[model samples]
Target: METPIDRIKLSQTAKDQLLKLRRNTKIDQWNILCRWAFCRSLAEPTSPSPVPIPQDSNVEMTWRVFGGEMSDIFLLALKQRCYNDGFPTDKETLATQFRLHLHRGIGYLAGDPNIKKIEDLVELATKKI
Candidate 1:
């Protein structure tokens, strides 16, 4: 399957948030943290607000790097999300929503007070939503 986005560039805010998450969770890879953030946002009941996020940070990754072995699954989930949200699944829309969801999810994770360690992250993933 063709991915809607080829490259992802995060905002400075997201970069900072991921840095904090790194310290808290001891997970060093940006791609791993990004995967978590993307899934976290997707789990939300409402669509992410269509806000503009500046790609001002130097942090960048290819879709393959970001998704690793789960690239196709991530793309499928994104397409399904667009369909469920009543949005077109065109590449442009998918890319836009991907950015919005990613940023929102990063913010959600960074702001959560309970995520103090890697186990907290696991607990969060296992918790009833």
Candidate 2:
């Protein structure tokens, strides 16, 4: 099977943010932190900005590690979002959108001041951002 995403490479700023998130939320795993970041971006009502983030950090993970057991569901959701956004579900589009949304989400999650505890993650699902 074609990998949903070959690898995820965070910008230096994003890597720094993820480190802060790890300390704040006490989640040691990069994949789990990234999952939170990805979902946070998806929860936004607006489409993510398409700025090209420089992949200048060493943080890289395969799609399998990032998605864990829900990888298939995550891929379907990504494809659905692409179709909704009038983008094709082609490989390049998927990869690009994944990076955009993931980075955007990471920024959002890291910047929120209320997310200092693991239980605060429920806010991502319940609170009206």
Ten residues in a row with the worst lDDT in model 2? 120-129
Q: Please, what are the lDDT tens digits per residue for candidate 1 over residues 86-129?
A: 99999999999999999999999999999999999899999985
Q: TM-score for all predictions?
A: 0.98, 0.94
| Candidate 1 residue runs with Cα over 4 Å from true position | none
Q: Evaluate model 1: give its lDDT.
A: 0.96
Residues 1-129, model 2: lDDT tens digits: 465578888899999999999999999999999888888887777778889889999999999999989888788878888888888999998999999999998999899999998889876677764
Enumerate residue pairs that collide in model 2: none
Q: What TM value does model 2 have?
A: 0.94
Residue 78 in model 1: shift from native, Å? 0.4
